[model samples]
Target: MRRTTRLTAAVLAFLSAPVAQALDTQTGPVRIDRIAAGFTDPWSFGFLPGGGVLVTEKGGRLWYVAGGSARQIDGLPDSVPDGQGGLLDLLIPRDFGRTRQIYLTFSKAQGAGSGTALASGRLDTEAGRIENLRVIFEMTPGSSGGRHFGSRLAEGADGKIYMSIGERGDRPAAQDLSRHNGSIVRLNRDGTVPDDNPFIGDEGAEPAIWSYGHRNPQGMAVDATGQLWVNEHGAQGGDEVNRIRRGANYGWPVIAYGRHYSGQKIGEGTTRPGMEQPEFYWDPSIAPSGMVFHSGSGHAPWRGNAFVGSLKFDYVARLAGDPLREVERISSPETARVRDVREGPAGGLWFLSEDDGALYRMVPE
Candidate 1:
């Protein structure tokens, strides 16, 4: 992989001027700047080791963006671009400098339908291509629909790979241990199941399952304390953020704070025995997506807090406090339909807006 700091003239021109006005919030004044634009349905992005970034579009395009110029990186795996399925989250591991290894999640064709799959490969920036690409894990393909593929990737503190897979629109399937749908799977970097996984010896249970009963958890992050947290979509009004526990059931269709789209009550009531409760929830459903726990000292006031993008509300939610609550709604025209939010390697917060088809950076003014 090669590194380049050369900036294209057009990008240099855009950066020469302020992209947007400074917005004051609880964290003080901050500026949101456009890093790159013209993406077609960008879903996620990751910062490269030396410089630049790798962005994924839902239409199966992987882009190498730097210095305000963008180029498509070849060698992407075969992915189905049907509805919500396509090239999704990207992960640039902590050891990318030495290993040059990166991970990605996409919807793969499984017989008649498609399911979420995880793949790993080496990024050759000099050639603008991926090499030795191989699928590490794939869900059992049965359900068929374009909605709720819940593909998100996170590197756990323990060095394991954590991925979220949605129920594929089959409500009851979230509770089925035999299926990989509607659950978070913990695996080794090479896509093998860890021996200490929650359901290792349980008969009929998929060994990769870390926790089950999630409706469509699109947002996941590990806190400073190494705790895993996930924000899942609710039926109508019950979007929830839960502190993920090993072997715990998160109660999706069974017990939810929201009602069905038809305004009918969901399975059972809100509180149910043997199921976990959300640490925080949104009554009107913000349609949350990518998530990241802010670290380092980029914005002193925002350190150690969590930032979640609201796809429905066109804002980034800052959640803090002991029990966790929304501290502020960071909004700007650049936040329209936020799909992913990640903390930059050096500092500051970066996000992708699906509506604008652009990438942005948020920094303290």
Candidate 2:
């Protein structure tokens, strides 16, 4: 009972129509189309400017998918595919048409361990390869475990690059400004620190640190209003969606809403005066990943709403309003282990399902 929903014509018609009213859910029946399949642990994907998509698999492979076909793209750096490590996120810059550049986040191998790394490269679709690939940044003093590489990328309205790195399973490091782990780092496109960074002249702090004390922020996006938002995983419960700010410390390991997996209490218990609070939190932990704010006429009713993928619960959570809260949970068989979600160019919602090993597009039916 599934069918393709043609949206190109409707998009054109919607362009000339009056603004549509926002609906709590879809205004009509919807269908999910399988964009491409056969992916193995696909981590992230981005739409190409012309047509098609670039997908990354945690096993260190990149694929160019389009027109129901897929081809591997060459020239990716070696990525360490240990537990919860490997190629993590892909970002297609707003200036891609002019720059032909793309950014990536991955687990870079470090001595006896690994660290979160940020890289940039030029995509040559005709050649099916990435050229001029180079590592722009790597977490300092890499840790000994393969866990907690909080690798997500976003380009701000001011044009600075933002990246998140987890505490590498070391709790105290989140509070240590000397290390890049457990903090969001802001940098120039060429890997240089911005002059106005919060810690430029500070004696024991990394210069690129913008905000500290975050734990495994896997999803990040810059909304239409230029506000940056992130969704991160919690130990057992206490997953959070936070509105990011400069020089702010989001308490980690120090204060949290959830207890440790073994039923032990976590640091100072939730509200610490100086630390910023989450705009929203999940008590049972959805194990969230991938984030996007919807826009455009194709999904007019959903404009400005936030969409996040839930890995543990196998669904996509739609959040909206001033006091952000989950308004809807879009779940189906194809949504299992939702790894990433993106707003398609035409304004349709597309998501990657790790369990299905496929990419799916949601469109009005």
Candidate 3:
């Protein structure tokens, strides 16, 4: 893979400019105010019905946040934290108020190996615990190695749950329909494959595949218009933010704008007629991990912008417009690796720090 030099201080400083008066909290762009701190390897979070937040730590712990205080919640299962495996994503069911259901994705140890696992349970808010926890699904048996656990969950307007599985460091597996690895799988709310899936009876294919040929997709969200969007890490310098579609092929090892870590060109080339291109991509790799559309009162001017976490860049990026026309990157006050970004119930931007493990709330400043 080609080794691109790091950005210079001057260049980084220019990119980290403070919000101007025109975009200030009262009249200018959106601003963020830090509210809470001190978390370890925070990964994903979801808001509770009453007014609390449920957060997951990559180190295998879950916490409940309310009124600026955080407390560990019991009833979490065992998780494999080796390599890139651990508690990864969390979400509240659409009928959360009625069913009290919560869903999560994590790396589970199967014998001596590990694979991604999806599970759900009831959140007993009054008791501050999870109940009736059960494994909904596990990656096809016998897969090992931890580089790619494409784990992100999104519930579509149609009420189907969509989950992404990484290629597990196996390039060709992405093109293989027989395996669930490296594909977007859609399931009914009860964890069964939807009968209307595209690959129902093809030879050796999993019926849950909605789209194939994806790398490690970590960020996923549904927009107001009900369109699903995904952000994935590229090989060396090609990080992409794509608008996902059913029955589509997102060229991975086959075609990439990025090169290998050894500086070698990846796949055949960047463009292929059948494969769909990303709506927006970053060269020199920001190592984007989490993404969410910004729609809150705190940042009025940025109401429609997309806020994404940058691990390699050590900052948060604000992408504006439908085709993502404008780009504004901001450095986090903590200067730690940003693992996840989400909109809080208070219309503020919530972020998790990967390295220092702290939870930060960004409100309009």
Candidate 4:
């Protein structure tokens, strides 16, 4: 294969003031080209088994892109696109080849409010539509606002689906196992509670909960060893990356390294007696959105590393080492907000810019 990153001395352009050109940086001299466009706050996407990619826009529309073109896919459930809540992540199941199915997380309309809902649909590529769309999971006690709807999905190595649900702007609910809010939930492919889930036998806890006490984890990626790692947003400055454990409680509102946006201390100090600590945290917050644990050697420099999209900094953080130190902040040609980042289908790196409503691929020059 060709080298993916070339060394250069010029600066990469920002997405907001895009020059439609590539820039050079320390990581490598890279070029960026738009793969698709016409998006309204596109959140996440995944490659299809046969070909093409499926993208979910926050406005509840799903699009299928192939051969440099994109089209809206029908048969989606109506979504409540209020504030930060809307259609979020797209998951391509492990058995996608046998079943042309995809899983989606969105803000579902509940009784008098909205909650995070997980649904699956069959992508009929030939007809450019979605079929057999069904609801698999929904968060309990839907909240009214749209502040924290953490909806990121990743299929684990053990044939189970892992979901990250935010606290729904409800700080206390994250500590309550009775509700699915503010949790890392594990479920079967059919949307049933996995028997191996941590709360399976709990008296009144939600059976789908795998771990609890998460703030607003927008990104989750299973590492090479099948370990689940999540990056969550802190109040003001405490964005965290934690290695997820079964049944473990990651302190959200209770113990956090960040202070409230209004300049107030959050819950006591940073350290609590029983709460799990983050493997890595950003002091001022990178506003982490998407993540991927790079495994293969397709890109020699990224092997065994993790790449995370930073909306605040408009760059991708390349993390390495056990403690997971950010080794480099890889800038893109477009300075627009990087909403999502993933390993590209052709082996380099792919990212979505929320500002420009476009998708770009980064490859070695």
Candidate 5:
């Protein structure tokens, strides 16, 4: 367990608002609506090309939502669903019209061992199945910790896919460039290491390593400028939002704003000379999971803000600032745990609840 600084009782209470003051919106205030229900620990959701959505449940199930009906997708790989290990992120290829490809990350089990795996397949919407599924990448061997599988996938402007891996709860692994755990990795759309990756020619290091030092990163998005951003769970209170840089080291375990759960300080101190500082951090631990940049036209002033989902605080936060600032927070009354949030394809917003397992759509009122 890690130690986190406690927030003031008043601040904690303020975060529990059902409906707070509305921000200046181009089209008035925003409201959220329930699109569907009856999800069992839903982890992530992705919108398809023509008004359908694919969702993954933590208990090894994939579902298709269309015409207001939820149907379980068939032909999914065997998954290890134990203690935060299960189906995770989902991404439809940017060129899906031409490629017909979909990517998924999940925990695979073999005997008593489990590790994260990334796979891609051609999705057959009419047949309601995934075809030609293939393993694109797998975590390193002997690293089987159930926690900190910081897995998220996003395609970069260069058409390469970027994946984030946590340190598997083993802090020392963050400094090990030779391991894929605790690193941001870049791979070609076809699952090969890009020749231009930061560690391309390094002998002992994985060629896909982009940046290192991360815990369980649940939220990741690339902005219009092609800059990558991520939000990760900190030990106790040091939940951080960071701008990912190529070849740079983000100091975790070694230097963190958070303490151990047992009320002990972590590593040496909070600030180190070479380590990058977080743009924004939550002291009492918001338990941020999903994140996306608000680039849709439905919310005018929100175009540049980053929206983050919180588990511990049960709110969606809007973060602003070139250096990142907490502009506002919107609490959800439906559930106490928000698993994921994304800007919808139709200029609205979509989010998933981890507890009650429901999908919500937000639009300008």
Candidate 6:
């Protein structure tokens, strides 16, 4: 039998949390609460400073969800919703209360080409619109086609923002530092280059690049100790979870654990000098995306564990241990294509489903 677990009235105004159905999980019995639905390719979401939630849809739309209701947020700029482009990731800066600013990753047009771009704007809650919208960063040498737009945002404690850019189906582009493709970028909160960035002073190099040679890095997070990690998608197989190292090369085209979609071999057999290997990898390609490292008392049993949403596997993988193993597979009985997994502000767990376009929360039953 299912039951409703109600939070205090104060908490209700924040998330509108309601009791849900119990399910058997590896850790224990838990309940899942449905947040808001009726989304069209909801790519990412984050908490608003005012206890609401902002969801970015791939079709150039943003929805403000709160109190069991949703409102369409206006002022979203034109973004191409192609193969893998559109409004991707959204983040509320830590200083949101003071700044009332939020960041977004979207695909911007460049001639006949498009590339991932980052923008920030002031959220005018009273008017339900964004003001002063500006694109702060754009991947250069924009390429045609939208097979890979690797866009995820994570803010460092230093108040700097980090983002991932895909190679746009151009394998060789990842090896070139002059172009922004296939790289992790660091920028000042205002979209200016960080002076200490690895390539800042180098001639003919992309100054925003913090790391290179990645293939569609879709998820990034910073742990409590300030360590950064990324979950990347592999071509046909070889999805990887890696620890981000400054100025390091991930050896995408040169070395890989997976093969080409045409059944051809890839790279120089997965070992190369000066190339960083993944801390963990999936051979058959789970098509990993959203990720978060859980720690805190709200979900005590999940503390110190890492959760990753699997696009191809239709489940969420709970990974633990230094070597990083998938300890549990949290799957919705109805086969949810998990797109994003996040650690809620209250220490609970939340995820977005692409299959049904619904938001769900996992909590103690």
Cα lDDT, model 6, residue 175: 88
Residues 1-365, model 5: lDDT tens digits? 01111212222332333432333343367776667666778899998887888889888878787764556677777777867888888988779988889998888764566777788899887887899988888777556657888778898888888887888778898888888778888888778888888887888998888988787788999887989999989998899998999888888878888888999999888888878888889998999988888885776777888888999888888887788888788764753588888888888778898886677777877
For model 5, the superposed segments whose C-alpha errors exceed 4 Å read 1-28, 110-112
lDDT of 4 by residue, 6-62 (tens): 101011122233434666756567777666665779899898865787888998877
For lDDT, the strongest prediction is: 1
Candidate 6 lDDT, 1-365, residue by residue in tens: 01111222223343454556687888888788777766778899999765888888898888777766566778887898988999999989888999999999999998899999999999987798999999989999559897789999999877889999988999989989999889999999889998899887889999999999999999888877788899999887889998998899999889889899998988788999999999999989998889999985575789888999988889889999887788998887433878888988787788998887777788766
- Residues 1-365, candidate 2, lDDT per residue (tens digit)? 01012222232333344432322344555677766766779999999886888888998888887654566788887889989999889988889999999898888888888899988899998898889999989999659777889898989998999998888889889989999989999999888999999989999999999998898898999899898888888898999999998888999989887889999998999989889899999999999999999885586778888999999999999899986899889877778999999999887899999997777788765
Whole-structure CA lDDT of model 6: 0.85
**What would the C-alpha RMSD of candidate 6 be, to one decimal place?**
5.0
Local accuracy of candidate 3 as per-residue lDDT tens digits, 1-365: 01111212222333344432322332344455444445567788888887877778888878776664556777776788978889889979778999998888899888877887888888886686789888888877567887889889988988988887888888888888887778888988778888889888888888888988888888888877788888888888888888989888898878888899999999898999899899988998988878888775655776777888889878888887769742776674553688888887768777877785556666665
Candidate 4 lDDT trough over 10 residues, lowest sum: 1-10
Clashing pairs in 2: none
> Candidate 5, after superposition: displacement of residue 41 in Å?
0.5
Question: Candidate 4: where is the Cα deviation over 4 Å?
Answer: 1-22, 333-335
Better of 1 and 6 by TM-score: 1
When summed lDDT is taken over every stretch of 10 residues in candidate 2, the lowest stretch is: 1-10
How good is model 4 by TM-score?
Answer: 0.92
TM-score, cand. 3 vs. native: 0.89
Clashes of 6: 2
- TM-score leaderboard ranking: 1, 6, 4, 2, 5, 3
Question: Model 4: how far is 203 from its true place, Å?
Answer: 1.5
Task: Give the higher-TM-score candidate: 4 or 5.
Answer: 4
TM-score of each: 0.96, 0.92, 0.89, 0.92, 0.91, 0.94
Q: lDDT of model 3 at residue 263?
A: 98
